[model samples]
Target chain A: MRLEKCWFCSSTVYPGHGIQFVRNDAKIFRFCRSKCHKNFKMKRNPRKVKWTKAFRRLHGKDMTQDSTFEFERKRNRPERYDRNVTMETLKAIKKIDKIRVAREARHHKMRMKGKKGIEQKAAERELEQGISLVKAPLALREESSLTLSKIKVKVSQPQAEYQMEE
Target chain B: MAAFVASKWSKVGPPLLDNLRSSRLLEPFGKFQDIASPGWNGLLFQQLRTFIQMRTKLKVVDNSGAKWVRCIQALKGRKGARLGDTIIASVQEAQPRGKVKKGEVVYGVVVRAAMQRGRCDGSEIRFDDNAVVLVNKQGEPIGTRIFGPVPHELRRKKHLKILTLAEHIA
Candidate 1:
């Protein structure tokens, strides 16, 4: 079975669903639903319908310009379906997603490094106010770098530091 | 249910018409006066959104000969639509021999909204029910003749072409 992309929405049209409109010039236009079919029959412009993906892409809303989307390459036939190749492609996509997730976690930690300093300052101020605060489990660990840093902070502030703060 | 009033009042249509009444008094400082000298009086605005806010399967008064229209979009936030707002509606009941076919979505502009709308002069005007006029993207009314009295506000917004085709403006 072959899948076709809808002319208006550019979504995949399954075998039993969607409509096909044949123009006077023998060109066929496929629509994914009755909504798209009706809009096309009414001669409505795709650009004016803000809900359609075509409108989103035309207006440049987070849509990337893929190489296959090039006007000249549009007519190029898709490669024939191969079961083995499809399986390999699926595995490759999953591997890429795993790598992407790990990279994003690293980037998040890097972004939060500066924010942590600000948070620690607030936590230290609260500690000076005699407020009983529960430290995070990671901070409670004796050998953790965060706990070592906290001890260093306590040692730096002496009786003279308390006098200066008031 | 229809109730007949005593014929002592001057005969126009009746003492109580449901809608589409004409009140022609201009109040002080350019505000439109509601009917006040009353045994039974008329209303100025014939349509408003609060009365019949745009909803699916709601009846539409089409002067263009389509018997029914189904509103698809009420535009701004869907809480309700107001006068001069654009809407998308589908023709539900159309004659087989009419200009528009059934299931065709047409652009409609709110000619009258039920909510009281404030004018530039700090005065407000409201209509009896929510009403829309089918128009093209160029803002031209598709109907040859508007069914009832049109408001001057439609013309004030530069829709003079609709005013030219209208039989009366109130």
Candidate 2:
């Protein structure tokens, strides 16, 4: 059975699942679920919607260009089936899957490499700007040295606290 | 002047004679009229591939109360009806309080056919079920709302009202 990709989310739509729409122009659009179909009916652009694969790909949030994806493409020309070839292909699928998973993890890590530093910097800036919210400005000046050290501790503390809250 | 006339005749006469011979050959089969008609050549091939024959049960895809309709006749040709073709049908089942009643004969337009139809873009489309939208003699759809996807072929068939009322145009 051939698996189709959802037009909106880019999720796999297996046979006997999802809805297929063939436009008057004969462009086939397969939706993974009613949610995708509804979004399409509303004329929402997949690239503009943040949840869609097109959005993630367009915004560089997901891997758009990758050789691993080439294997999953539809091949109209049929390959001559042989017992040995089929057996080899079955074995290769597992190896390919492992490689693809590792590559995806690496891609995700690369995308998120500087995210922690950027988030920390933004938090620090916000804390500096909103320092008066936590402590009065007049009192901060009197205890500036003590508060600076306390603030540093508080910055690290909040992150741990946030994780605990989650 | 005779030589010029002969040259002119030489250019057109053989083709006209060939056309006459072909028409005469096809006349016994009763398809010559369809072949000779302007703009019918395209539809002639389509008619051969059409699947909705007389008595074919089609799902009514409009809110007009018809649930199922049995085709009584194909409006366009004798063979069968394809996508975007008009057909005369009798409502087999319908909503009791709906606009139309059971056994009511109505004019309808084929919106989606179970048979695969090829498009200009080299793609083929086939729907899960054969469907039709109830229309009046004026070719205006009886239903204000169309429930499912309608093909673009309807637009070419001049069924713009049905297209506008459709939920989706696939």
Candidate 3:
């Protein structure tokens, strides 16, 4: 039997436990428990929930970026750790943590700076709105004047290969 | 001390009535499946890949190519869409003066796909052809008639009326 990670919590999911949802695209999502499945059904983001591992990783709580946690880092110094050297290290760490606190506050503001795109900002824009471009003032929307905003035009790169002048 | 403590209880205000953070409509779709991750399982059919791109022309399978559709957007920014995705499309070819006319932009939900979709239960699902059902601006199917199989996801989205009209549900 193969082991899978729970889609919501990022925990190990053994077979015979947890429910799975296969989207129409055939992408499978396996959840470890009813709580995770219910959270998925209710449209909850695992990255937003404080309890999940996704939240830890997404918000940089992954211990990799938690500079304060460096005090308990796995790396060992090659030389002997003397009392004075250790004390100096501790003092430097204390000062670093103080700086990190201020840096984190600045990062928090920067992370919240950007806005979502206009289309996704509203949930039911398509359902509530009509096609304004199609129903133009003129019949058949005169080809030259038609502003097809949604349709993307194919841009050919002519400059990629150039002919040498004789 | 007892008189002073009793007076403080009256000074406190009652709890607020309305809950401020209960908005659910901000999300475009619930149960979104991420197909852009490192490796997306297996091959998504090539025809289905081009079936719903910008300026893609689709023949109404049930109608035998009589009606044509040109896809605009896949509703999500993923650039391409798969089965059960709703697309904004314009009717390029339809019966003259019919219920749906040429040049009318409408919402079409993909009911079938040539792409093989896999289930969580280790089973694979594939359809023979690509198909769609036109829906109104309200996300409900326009006509009372549906030609072919529809997905259970659509029914779960409260498009039960469309299922009642469809021949089958996959």
Candidate 4:
């Protein structure tokens, strides 16, 4: 086999002595070792070095009429889709979403295990300081109020009067 | 692991913040406020240390948040004397060329121009807006006046410009 010229140094490269480097410029270069490749990289001037075959052929300015563009267009095509099947898929998606939400809630609880202590401490401090940490929707406001009343009853003896009357 | 890092930051970081916040040096200069969470004190310390170590190219904004202090060289004595031009001239006249050895106080100022942080917006960043003058012993300005070294490559091209917030300094 005829010897290949080293792309960087232009030296004759034996069969196993070098590897080929192809650049966006469409030039092919062979380097004897990584050291030469590194030195080539260390050169600050961009105009000094030449890149190899694949780089040049792949990167240069877009030539839309190139054969590769036709090949790429043929490889990627829209799938034949049916609208009726999409609605069925959407129904199945809703079921899947319900299950996914349940799983996410479990995962959320697991993640909260470590932070629960911190939250509890904050909650206890808020309670001791007579601060409200209640967060609930308007629909649950009456229920939350009842819950608060029960808590207040348990914490103090004011509810004993009602119980004795009953 | 996140908590550990946060805890370490809290415990180890305050002294540096204290240095930045309590630089009694800044009190007389201008209204330096802390907007940071833990505070500007820690941020200032970290920035100061980074500037001193040459780890960053970013210049420091003085306590007033107006001027940028680049190429900082600090000589210390008293901070009061270097406030006005008279003090700066007197100190320069008293000690001529070379280093003013014993009685010399250090002054630290930014060498390159300072732009108000938000001038592109309406709010201008100023040097003297909130600045403190650090002076040396016997009340002189010799301690610190930022100079773009005469013929040096890195600093020579840069000229010093002070961004005045108000007509405070005469």
Candidate 5:
């Protein structure tokens, strides 16, 4: 079972251990244990409860909402968490990376546009050096971008050469 | 209280310059969700009353005992909107458009998930004493809070470390 962070307290939660309360409205609340659960139950005033029911009644379950709910429920459920989630999350995270990359690319392109060839060459060199020092993973471990099996072959190449010499 | 609870339209106060002639032709309808105050309950109840009144097509929707309706009403028009046609239409017209401006509003992903499950987004902003408020990729806001204060032990840890998954594992 995958460990989950308590939605309420950020405590670690193990499967089969926490209290599961499905809001009378179908929303699931998982607690790490009884303490957080007790507090959660105790904190409920008439106002919060009415707000919850009203909101649920307002937004009837539909596909987009269901998927989002599933993503979260699956996020906590280890069985549904796999490469799919990782890929989706990575794709989403890539939006941030793309923004930075595009900014630099545009800035560099602008700097080179009006420069003379010789000065542009020097500028390009400076830019390359600057980029080299950025320490981005894509720049640092370019070779490791290969598949795991390819990485295994690369790792074993020196041993193979040594064995052939022997 | 007005700064936080008042809608942007309310802050701008009725338009001084009506570029769009539609404003001149159409009678400026009073905003549907206009009574929000700093008090959490008052804002929620008024909005819910509007939602029910609009949903039922009745001009007046009474709030008998449901206090949560206040927050619920503000929640009516998002994604899978649930309130009646009249309220939903008013909410749509009243909703601020495009991306967030002003100070960013931050919220937690779990809370986001909870709200999405219930089909609402703005509710998470109300009582987040513990959630971290940060900026996200959209340059939009993000915030999260555990339901309570940070435990003393967590105060010394790093950002992600402070948020433990131990309680959510099940």
Candidate 6:
């Protein structure tokens, strides 16, 4: 059985699963679930939806251009199967899968290389903006200390005045 | 001068009209026009190769207690009924004490046609069995639940109730 991709989310729609919508013009759209179908009915763009593969690809979160992806593409032409070729292809599939995984991991690492520094910078900026919420204001702290000392001097002066009066 | 121009136009106009009528470009639009017309009786269009017969057996896909039904007549057309078309069928088999009794005639909407239907996206779909869901005179389904996959074309045919009751739309 041939596997279909969901029109909305780019997810695999296995046989006997998912819903297919054929428009009046004869265009077919397969949805993996009711959620994708509902989103499609709402006229939401796949690239605009944050959770969809189209969104991730458009936002540079996933590898968009890769030779590895070419292997998974659906080809209309069937190849003549030979015993030796089949064995080689089976061996090649495992090797290709391993290479693809390694490439994908490398791509992800490259994409995330500066993520830590960017996150730290963002945290610093946030702290700079909201530092007063977390800690007392330096100027206010200094002023409060001076005010406390002044209050102590005033209290002492009041005691001296009371003592003089006594 | 006017008479001369009219005579000249007549010679050109008929051939042009004939060419326009015979052209392949307007063929699909003509089918669309038939669909758009309110009085369309499904006579001129033969979308499906095989049509349901008067005595054709249909598997009921709903829980309204009918297991099988035989078509007595297809409504709105003398030829036959395709997917999404409604037919008057007599209950051939049903569960005991069910809402529908055996031998009772009921209206049913065709949910799945065994013949393959071509889509505009260069794909074709065919169901394994010919199935129907019992409905009333008001075009609303009598069954509360549907068991198998139905086509999205039913929705285009304005069978929203069937689409809602369906487990899947293919």
Question: What's the true lDDT of residue A163 in model 4?
Answer: 58
Off by over 4 Å in 1: A1-166, B1-62, B76-78
Backbone collisions counted per model: 7, 4, 0, 31, 30, 1
Residue range A1-166, candidate 6, lDDT tens digits: 5888999999998876666665433356888786786677566789998999999999999988899899889989888979999999899999999999899899999999999878766664444333344433444234445233434443554456556866
Residues forming the 10-long window of minimal summed lDDT in candidate 4 chain B: B81-90
Please state the error at residue A32 of candidate 3 in Å. Answer: 25
TM-score for chain B in model 3: 0.61
Winner of 1 and 5 under TM-score: 1
Give the best candidate by TM-score.
Answer: 2
Candidate 2: list runs displaced more than 4 Å. Answer: A143-166, B1-170
Query: What docking grade applies to model 5?
Result: incorrect
Clashing pairs in 2: A22-B170, A23-B170, A24-B152, A24-B170
Chain A, model 3: TM: 0.38
Clashing pairs in 3: none
Query: What docking class should model 6 receive?
Result: incorrect
Between candidates 1 and 4, name the one with more favorable DockQ: 4
DockQ (model 3, Cα): 0.01
Best by lDDT: 2
Clashes of 6: 1
**Two-way TM-score contest, 2 vs 6, winner:** 2
Error of 3 at A70 (Å): 67
lDDT of 1 by residue, B99-133 (tens): 66788888776665446565444334444445567
> Which stretches in model 3 have alpha-carbon errors above 4 Å?
A1-166, B1-51, B61-66, B120-122
lDDT per residue as tens, model 3, A1-166: 4667888998877766766654544466778887786577566789888899989877765433766656544444465869999899888988888877777777666655653444343422442222222242233124423333322131113212222211
Error of 2 at B85 (Å): 14
lDDT tens readout by residue for model 2, B1-170: 33343333333322233344444433445645554533334333432335898989999989999999999999886679887889999999999899999999999998988676665544455665688999999999898998878888788889999888877778
- Among all windows of 10 consecutive residues in model 2 chain A, the one with the lowest summed lDDT is A146-155
- iRMS for model 2? 42.7
